[model samples]
Target: MVRGLTVLCWAVATPGLLWAAVRLLGVERGPLVQLLAFTPYVAGWSLLPVALSLALRRWWPAGVAAVAAVALIAVVAPRAFGGGSPAGGGGPTLRVLTANLLAGAGDAPTLVRLVRERQVDVLAVQEFTPEAAARLDASGLAELMPHRRLNPVAGTEGSGLYSRFPLTATGVRENPGGFTQAYGTLTAPGAAPATVESVHPAAPYSLGQLRAWERDLDAQPRATPGGPIRILAGDFNATLDHAPLRRLIASGYRDAADATGAGLAGTWGPYLPDQRHSSDRVPAIRRMAARITGDRIPPVTIDHVLVDRRVGVRDVSVLRLPGSDHRPVYAELALPRAELGG
Candidate 1:
């Protein structure tokens, strides 16, 4: 009986050890991509296996579980505490916000109210529809953010950018992932010019689209340390745990949420009991992922605002609105000197 119980402890620790291996190696593929988003939760539970093995007086299982627990904690613990790079060159603070409106269905007044209350200087929007654009305009979005470059269509492919500052060299480009990305050069007074892109990468909904999702992430331009300051903001459909996003960040961008220790806040699936998940309209994979994560929060932080490393991150927060699964991500950034972007 003792031997059988020890075997059970080994079984419990094995999956977590595999998870740690996949995460550490960045080898998670297909549906595993969705599951890897739950790394933080798994890291917390890893302690249980260690305790159980030790209590059962099984040294081998205990050692393995302790190794897995340490590895998981090393990967996940840093995000919960703040100590991001202080790279700002002492320029003006730029308040930026990004949100995905869920195909014209998200509440427009609430978005406008967030902008008004938050004093957002730049706003990046994904899943923007023409009707939603008109609704936002009707709700007095133009009064707050007069300058704009929008490509609002009827479906999830549309994207847009609105700013209090002027936008130049503005255009909409269809990314390989089948989403329209709105981008432009933003000129803020007393600070350098920043090129901002509204990002909406293809979600790896199925095994077939996985390549497309990878292409989308790969196509996202890396931050140019020697060139213009850049900010990529919106529903990336990928999280910090993903390898491609990690590569993107390594190329010179800083995740606002991760910088401020809000990285663990679930951004995608609130995963409630009610049919309220009905409103979010996520695909079967996400719903399954919700179940895998115990159908509660559903390991997710897909929406992000990644800024150039030259900028200093002051604060990051998440805000909610009705009818959208993704909440708005707001970041307070201090841009570098005016010449850094030139």
Candidate 2:
């Protein structure tokens, strides 16, 4: 019994150790390897092996698992609990909200209510469908946000940006895989106009999709700290653990949630029912199970509000939106006085 238990402990510890090594090495070549990039997002699962090793009194295996947990914690803990830069002294504050409409199925009235309640200055939406756009327009959002740049597509590729300030449609960034992103300049009253992009990279579900997602992320323009203050807000389909997003951050952009110590809050999970299931009853059951289990699928933070270093992220929060799998992310930002067109 002792020997068998020891073998079981090793079996549990090896996989986590290997995954930790992969993350440390930053190897994202094939589909399987690319999937490993998300291991850190679910790093909490590593504790299972540690618990097992401790129960079996296997110190070496327990130590190995503990090290694996520590390594992952080292990677994620700073973002989860680290200190952010102090808020800038003088500048106009802009409150921005971003949401994925779940292919236009999100509740229009609920969204409008959020905008009004939060006093959002800029709103960015991904997976915008024409019907959803129509509903949003009719919900009095247009009156609140007169300046708009909408590119409503058939499916999940559509994107839109609305602002209380003036907006000039720059262009639509259409990926080869049919992923469309809309960007424009938002002219605030006292601040120099900033470029804002509604970002939604392709989901990396398979090898081809992974390649496309990588391409989409790599194609994003880098932010120039001293130049125009740029904001990229939407569902990135990649997390901080991904190498491409890390590179993007290294290029002078900062995630608003991270800046405000809200990075640990998850925005994506199994809240919405899976529409792909053949039977409606199955989806209902699945949702019920998820609710009962407290959504044990291990939620991930895929949606973000990224801004240039010159912008100060004063606060960040996440809201649950009806009819959507993702929670809406809102951030209050302040630009430096020099960038305020003083």
Candidate 1 lDDT over residue span 103-139, tens digit each = 7667789899999999999999998998889999999
Candidate 2 global lDDT = 0.80
C-alpha local distance difference test of each model: 0.85, 0.80
Candidate 2: which stretches are off by over 4 Å?
A: 29-41, 54-57, 86-90, 274-296, 339-342
For all predicted structures, in order, the TM-scores are: 0.92, 0.87
Model 1 lDDT on a 0 to 1 scale:
0.85
Q: 1-342 in candidate 2: lDDT tens per residue? A: 989999999999987787777677766667644465457554778899999999989999999999888887777777676357534525778899999987787778889999999999999999898888899989989898888888998668899988888888577888766778888888666776788988998888667687788888888878877577788999988877778887887788899998778888888876565323322222244446546765555677899999887777888999978777789999988866644431
Clashing pairs in 2: none
Q: Using alpha carbons, what is the TM-score of model 2?
A: 0.87
Candidate 2: count of backbone clashes, pairs at least 3 residues apart or interchain: 0
Model 2 residue 281 lDDT score: 21
